[model samples]
Target chain A: MARKRGLFETFQERIGAVLPSALQEAQTRVDDRLAKIPTRLNEYGYDAFGLHPESSRRSLATSTLFYRHYFRTETFGIEKVPSGRVLLIANHAGQLPFDGMMLGVSMLLEAEPPRLVRGMGEYFIPQLPFLSWAAERGGNLVGTPENCVALLEADECVMVFPEGARGMNKTWDHRYELQRFGLGFMRLALQTETPIVPIGIVGSEEQQPGLMNLEGLAKRLGLPSLPVTATFPLLGPLGLLPLPVRYRIHFGEPLHFEGSGSEEDDVVQRKVNEVRAAIDGLLQEGREQRAGVFR
Target chain B: MEKVLITGIGSGPGRLLTERLRTRFEVLGVDRTPWEDHPAEVAVHVLDLRKKGFEDLLRTERPSHVVHMGFIRHFKGDPNRRHEINVRGTKQLLDHCHRYEVTNLVVMSSSYVYGAFPENPFYLDEDQPLSASRSYPEIRDLVEVDTMATGFLWRHPEIRTTVLRPVSVLGPNSRSMMAEYLRQERAPTVLGFDPMMQFLHEQDLTDAIAMTLEQDLAGVYNVVGAGQVPLHTAIEETGGVAWPIPEPLFRPGVRMLFGAGMAPWPPGAIDYLKYPVTLAGDALAQAIGFKALFGLEETFRSLRGRG
Candidate 1:
């Protein structure tokens, strides 16, 4: 039988034959250098970690690292960010919660972007030395009102998903549905009257297909439901892993609540609804754009 | 059982009510300004919530009840100014409230919110919806709701948030038309027979606050004091005569003089010339455990620099 060889394999074989030190070359090009920033910046909740491009050289050296990777990670309507200490709210998508991570990375890339995001929960920071080093320098942490206000007062941008755990755990059955958002964000916004910048993350769900509901297994595990994708359950290990799908992030304009004082119940409820609606609209827009990408 | 911190405690109803409850409570008094010789004042801290680092102060002195009394009458300036403290700073305080589990809260609102006029009878009760009126008072209404929305905390009750609107606090330092006339030497002037006004003495105002704190109430209330009379009569009772000032001279001065930060707004001023805004709240007063401690006789008598 003739040996079956494809164009991708043939290209790899040719590279291996030409440069016998191929493994070494690949290792040198993808070295992960995560350095810690000054503690003062950390105190203010700033992290430089992997954010700084390898400053020693340009495209050839490691300096343009974050830029090369993230420059391609596109975002739209960032001008919609509300000025001042605002609650940066967005929809939660994907089982791994990469949506939140990329959003934080985008803010760091912002021009004079207020001290990265030094306010979020500690759980999101992966324990890996390289990732943690990057996160520490980047100033990403937990999502609490106290932390949010501290970050805002420090002039650092703070991001929070009002739906908390439930929102991020959204499955295929309810991809864009919002769980009951904790009213804490609303209260803080009203009390601080911080402008709210609604962000929407699409394509994350497609990256990790959530196809089915395994009722018996999920109940024993105590999760909302298993984080499965459309064809994943049949794929086993690959099913649990995320597909490298294209992603899109969109931001809606800032909303300022004119009345910051005691509101009648109806008025308060209405304002909260408006903010939620804006986020929903942005999410739909992002999904639509990502849909066209697939077509 | 819960630690309550009331700021701007040296003046107005804030200090009086705080002092009364201080003996039995762990109350922290904060004010940026001086005490101005208030008779009943507990230990007070000089600090401005409006200034930055408000969150730092809150983290250090975490109290359950944050009765915000520091904000003044006027809400004009940079449109973004009120958000500095009224909204953002208050959020900083609420963040501490949640951190320390200091759930109970009672913030003072203005009866001028009867201005929202949400297509209903303008009785200024809990029933009226406080929509945005693009005015300072209306903004305060929003501030109240936003603070209350922070969380449906469970501590003293199912939820802990209350807003009190005192219809024209009648007292010594008040800038009511009666107050302004007291500062002047000549007779008071009426544009078109200033509308009847309600009065609530400092003590009565203080007492209402004390009652609200003691009861640990949630939601909104209109604390309208009894015994009201026309603005001119109210001024006359304060030992000033009414001289009808012509629209020509009066209009410019009202526009120029009172229009500054030292004065209140239109309905706050000119609205008095109309029929008068009677703030009647039977259910609210009953719910909060308050009795009209000062009547027209007492409120009028007290305005002459007397008890």
Candidate 2:
């Protein structure tokens, strides 16, 4: 009974089935390796969460619990993505970051077990010496033009948040709508010829909305903004706190763009428009399905 | 031709619908065969219904109008099995419906959801909450949610669905008050007091199913008998001895019997027996447009006669 399994258990079962034992051995080996390089790693990424958890297998357990507790959402078009190398692009909805984490969890929960699906993240963080070293081990990579090209070519289910820094800023309307997607994804799909999957993350904006902005405070703190939320959660004594609101990540169809051009720019741009149209369809669908995924 | 596939044909309403629907469409019946008995015209297909991949059957049948009827009874063993068949099966069915682009679905559920015993003088209906907290009710309640949600949440809204929950059926071949009367007859002796009872004839259930399927309707409904009776009367009508067993004597023994694993009432069934009470179904009567053909007396008479 599919409904009996529901979305939570079904994702757990399918995704759990996919993690290879070799990855387990590799992860174990990596854990052992990371123990030796722990001190050097913190130089790149801030927030030492006791050094990131070794296993990427936290998709099912963590994803299910996170959604159940935080984001009360409904799902649709989840069965649309056929198993294979796919890319999920969405809007990043927070000044600080949790949008990527939430969507990462959704992808894990949505995909079958041993989901080797990887996320294509910004390169800046990973290139930060040791942090970049940890990012590579922890499945974080830069979304640079060349990096994305390689990631998509490698068949990684890379997730690109086009709005990036711009979309995360506070707005009055609470629109988590995507900013103009750069030509990078369109170019990547043309280059790798892999299907581009667009995901729309709603509810993430409200989970912790930045109703007010402080630019000077941001300059002093070296942060994005002094985005005031309903609650300023204390991270550590001096660290910034975030408002805890629920979140929902919605994924859409894979806009197939494989081999649309025989290395011709005209053909590639036409294919790019088709892919854009597909992404737009998904974005519109995410908006229409607002009743379900959003509050 | 309306492609009609009904699941759980061997159980209650599924079987009732199978008999009632055989005349109208290409009826493909799904049920776990206790033993093979093909009622010509209604092609019966055996399935665990819970296990994955059974959607292949739903696909092959290519039913335009699906009547999802399969579900293990509350008395059935393994609650996981219950959730597996009812909840998962509906999900599978909904998925199949989506894949096939089938337009209509009709599912059968229980009026027992009304949270009451048959003896309760008050009427039981669709509005009453299933009081879903209890174990058995939880299974049935969740099943109802999936059933209802399948209709509500599908991506393709073209498929209209109908969910019917029939009260204790008493029509032809249905073992209504007879089972209770027989139970009260303490082997050779009979119990002194019997509870009040309400029942719906299986034939009336058949008619209601036919009517609902013919018209496209999406909602939950209650099916109950026309009249009610005390179990004492039901016992007499069924030719069983009506011996009054005092509560003081009956209560302790029954409790002890149940406490020991030897007793038959599974924990859920124990709560079932204690049905708090419920109201009559007004919504179902208006929606289906009919009256229950068999009362307690007729139900007993029909049971007295056949298989």
Candidate 3:
């Protein structure tokens, strides 16, 4: 059993030695940010939603590469994200969820005091293989109202994308145009008495540049949408990789609505529309400010 | 001392519960299978719950408290026979409880009755519908039994009926599917899915039962453990390597293994491996001040070898 170290073992041993100084610094920053965030972990060091600091570190370390170099994400008014029990409502795009990740990275690295933002993901997220537990470990829970209420009650920051699949799967022609917002987030905010921070993301829509949506194919494949992106069908799986577009994220002022959560559909929709219009304004402002998608 | 008639006293939990309750109440046991070694203080009756002899035993004993836990929990038995004993037997027992004026009736239900669906929220309350049978038809009998006991609770207000839907109970001698799954050196898991799981230490469940009788809580309540953990973490904590299989192969594979009597749980139990069925124990805690003494690590460790 006393064998000499093989070439593979030698390479593995030098992982830390080989890592660039930028990566080592990023890893330290991720660990430090994660340590400062207060989580109600059980004795086994996992939250109810399976968010562990160890898992978060690995996920964040990988995301840090894309956040810093790939996307070069810039944030504005991140300090407007109130400390306790608030919602970060943003427009979701990029056939994948890089927008959500960038928003989360902004909260962790850019926001004052570095808050941990829990993204309320779709229900089908748990059905996928590796993405299932990875999302949970990254602090993204299934977007059930009860889960949202529980997290808000615990005084944690929750990020919500009211447009859902419609926004994420929209074609390039409909880019920067907000879809119909779901009123569930408004109802939850009202019920929990939590403030909503409207946010707008600029460059994610240009990442994949979806041409058209194949709804029937998506249904048969059990996916939300099968977007025929410019690069996807042409380049196959390689095309699924999003373009390195510069991301401009703007966090608007917190919006608070009054009344019990049992309001009529129109009443809730009106509140939802107000938040949607705020996001539209932000999106327009972001588009006008950015020189180009790659800038 | 007050008399408490316990059904399914032959099972591991039944025996543990009898030992825990015998000190305070006069414990009499009933089960279709014989319990070979039982304390002399507790009378263990080996008779089918549907048989007339069982009703006669209840009538003659006239026990004021009845704890019904006699249903077969595993899928190894005949379906028709299992249903007959679980459903028909529960009906007969409830009739006897009403006729004999059993002041307190505690039906040992499980959180599984809620069903492990992706739509299930983090902390399901008591009022949530019993939708387990929707996906898992094999567990329909348990759901029916819970429904019957709940109806009995409303119909007979005199008898305080407490239907406890506790999370998976685990311990050294636990015959629970979870305990059996953890015992495996390579436990198969659904690839990509690791639902958060809750575990109640066997002793904590026994205490909850005892406390239920002492307090006479009348309603359906979800008895949660101290906390929850991911399925993979629980497997690791119990010294088992999680063998993740894709859903397509894992479901039918488990089904075949179960049909051949090689696997511990049925194929329908795979949803549990995929989605969470976490419960809110706040009701029980607020009602009886119930707090679990054992943590998740200790609970998972109990499933390891008794050594």
Best of the candidates, DockQ: 3
> Per-model C-alpha lDDT, please?
0.56, 0.55, 0.88
What digit string (tens of lDDT, one per residue) describes model 2 on residues A1-295?
1121144356555644674453344344434433443232222221111113332333324444445545644445666655555677667666666677666555444444323344555534522323333343345554556555555554556777666666777653656555555556666766676776666666666555566677888879775466665455334423343344445455666777666334566656676556556555665666675554435
Name the docking class for model 2. incorrect
What TM-score would you give candidate 1 relative to the actual structure? 0.43
Question: What's the TM-score of each model vs. the native?
Answer: 0.43, 0.44, 0.95
When 2 and 3 are scored with lDDT, the better candidate is 3
State the lDDT of candidate 3 residue by residue for B1-307, as single tens digits.
9999999998988999998999899999998888888898889999988899988998899999999988888887788888888999999999999998899999999999999888788889999999999989998999999999999999999999999989988898687778877888988888777788999999999999999999988998888788998888888888888887888999888788988988767888999999989999999999999999988878988887644
TM-score top scorer: 3
* Candidate 2 accuracy as TM-score: 0.44
Predicted complexes: DockQ each:
0.00, 0.01, 0.50
Q: Give the worst 10-residue stretch by lDDT in candidate 3 chain A.
A: A1-10
Clashes of each: 35, 34, 1
Report the C-alpha lDDT of model 1 over A1-295, residue by residue, as the tens digit: 0011143246544655665464334325433221221223221122221122231112112112222232235678876675557678887766665676667655544323322344364343332222332332334433445445555654445687777656665666777776666566666677675788887776665556565556668879754456556656677776665555555678788888877636676777788778788888987877766645332
- In candidate 1, what are the lDDT values of residues B1-307, reduced to their tens digit? 4566786676556766766777767776777677766544345667767454555666776666677666544445653565465665565555565666665676666655554211222233455555435333425634453335433333335437666767666676555433544445444344433343566776777777777767777766777776555455566666655665644666566667655755444333433333234465676667876767787766766767733
Ten residues in a row with the worst lDDT in model 2 chain B?
Answer: B187-196
lDDT of 3 at A285: 96
